[model samples]
Target: MSVKYAKRMDYIKGSAIRELLKLTEQPEIISFAGGLPAPELFPIEEMKEVCVRVLDTDGKAALQYSPTEGYMPLRKIIAERMKKSGVEISPEHILITSGSQQGLDFCGKVFLDEGDTVICESPSYLGALNAFKSYLPKFVEVEMDKDGMKMDELEKALQANPNAKFIYTIPDFQNPSGITMSVERRKKLVELAVKYNVPVVEDNPYGELRFEGERLPAIKHFDTEGMVIFLGTFSKIFSPGLRVGWVAASPEIVRKYVLVKQGADLQSNSMAQREAAAFVQMFDLDAHINKIIEVYRKRRDLMIETMEKEFPEGFTFTYPNGGLFTWVEMPEGVDAAEVLKKALEEKVAFVPGGSFYPNGGNENHCRLNYSCMPEDKIVEGITRLGKVFKKL
Candidate 1:
């Protein structure tokens, strides 16, 4: 039973949130550990109709093998949607992938080599960190303020690491931190990438989920030199189980993704792409997203309010206008993992923020998800967690 594995496997580990999900699966546990969407808001009936229509009209084509570049109609729909984010793109430059998670893997495959450096926000998305880690690259995490990653620190990192592969960012209501990059910073980020001659991988799964303020243009929108790679997904706005996402870049760049796609999984789910396109054609996706915004905005508001009233003094958390998470920073000496142990005793769960950092050592933080739980459960869970933190 002896076997050998690749060296890259040494850098890979199971996701902290994924492991926590298993522990919190009990019926009574009020889990806020996962960045999951509310199941009640899914378009089950519309999808049911869309599925039968696709099968009845184009059954074989729906199930058959598709181009690595994805279904033309779906790509076109995605391209049209890109205009909302201020990017004028064509379907020819889009390559469909299983999910944005796969898009992250492709970025690693295309840009990284052993000992290469990656520039990311200090507390970036855990999933992206794991995906990039498989390539054995060193991470240079930049500090962040309320407006997202700091530009001066990013410039210093870029200057310090000349062999940096790419700058990875979740600019729109960023995961774990829930901070959005301002419009000026978005433009400055592109400027820095252009100057540094490094590509910017914009992981924007939550850009469209804005609950307040005007929507800002994507980083790719400012990329006149085609140095930005935009990853878009249906997981947040539509069905995650469909596993439909795309890489929108320049033609030359996306052709590389298509080649990678052929080697990765051949193509994304054909039926799922067709169904997503049909759903768009058959219904008002904007209205559907509006419904999601209404529900999640209320949840976000309630969670922030409850935390304000219940949590003790000196503990700080973000009041996110949109997205799934809000990060809580405990006092310097406090360990969130210890807080979790006590909270679990009261049938509650959340992700400790230490694992969110690729280089580690911020154990006094935690990420809370409000988009998955009901209002009553959110209140009850935050109250229980408040008591746990107060004890510490």
Candidate 2:
């Protein structure tokens, strides 16, 4: 017998970033595609100790079903972390998910409806676009300047789409562009969101990975009316494979997320949660993050240096203070996807920037990840990419 699937399934397209990632597996390819942290930096020995300790102390509890909200201890730690960001939240306002990607999915499920309007920065994170697209929201793009989203355009978009459900922003060291929103812009964004009476989804996975700048207050810090849903993850700071992330929102919104989590997976991995709690308690997470910052900072410098020395004169790139990626904008009329194909032919890979935009358009841009590759490899990869660009 033939089976029929929901019509919504047809609207979903394969993730362009993931498809590009698959092509990067060849040993000859020098990949700058994924936003993965360097695997060498994961504290394997500390994690091993935590794993043994959890099994010895509470193996059964770790393996058994957990409350949909999350492990209480981890939730408490999350609440404490939120306090440092100036967001006053409690364990009651937290819901753990398998990963922050799942948090993105839950956000779409809880807040979005087909044909509802959602605003995102132009050339935003592709993964978020993929997650939200399943629900079929009409994504409105706001132009971004060097400081962050253009306030004038943002105000115009909000006025144009007054029915917008929420504004999603990666305010600190944003993904593809690696541009941090200025403190003034941060305040203005929060003001606009409050003025428009629309909630903001503040995705902040990379905020703590800053290597060379003062930390700014998160948009959630200005959320007096409980209109911002803040998403955080241990993946970047700790182990991504552990798949641990949390959502901090108003108690009322968090309650709905709890019910949604119950239907999605019941709970995040309890063993991972317990081990994460131990990792935070026993090890100096700040020290570990500092080391990561050092590694990535050097790599970022190398990539920037190579690009400057090798790339054509017209090409421009972002100088991010902190974040995994550097965005390169090619000369106008140059297609980034075509450059990507030529670079791949030269055994190098990067995510073409078109995929990052909601409408799949930005032909002159592409994203390169410097965090995962060694300095030498970054030099080699960009050199190869330079050859491709020159040829084009």
Judged by lDDT, which candidate is best? 1
For candidate 1, list the clashing residue pairs, or say none: none
Residue 48 alpha-carbon offset, candidate 1, angstroms: 0.8
Q: Mind giving the per-residue lDDT tens digits that candidate 1 earns over 330-375?
A: 9998888988899999999999999999999999999999999999
Task: Give lDDT per model, in order.
Answer: 0.94, 0.89
TM-score of each: 0.99, 0.98
Q: How well is each residue in 71-143 modelled by candidate 2, as lDDT tens digits?
A: 9999998889877678888788888989999999998999898999999999899889888988989999988
Q: What is the lDDT of candidate 2?
A: 0.89
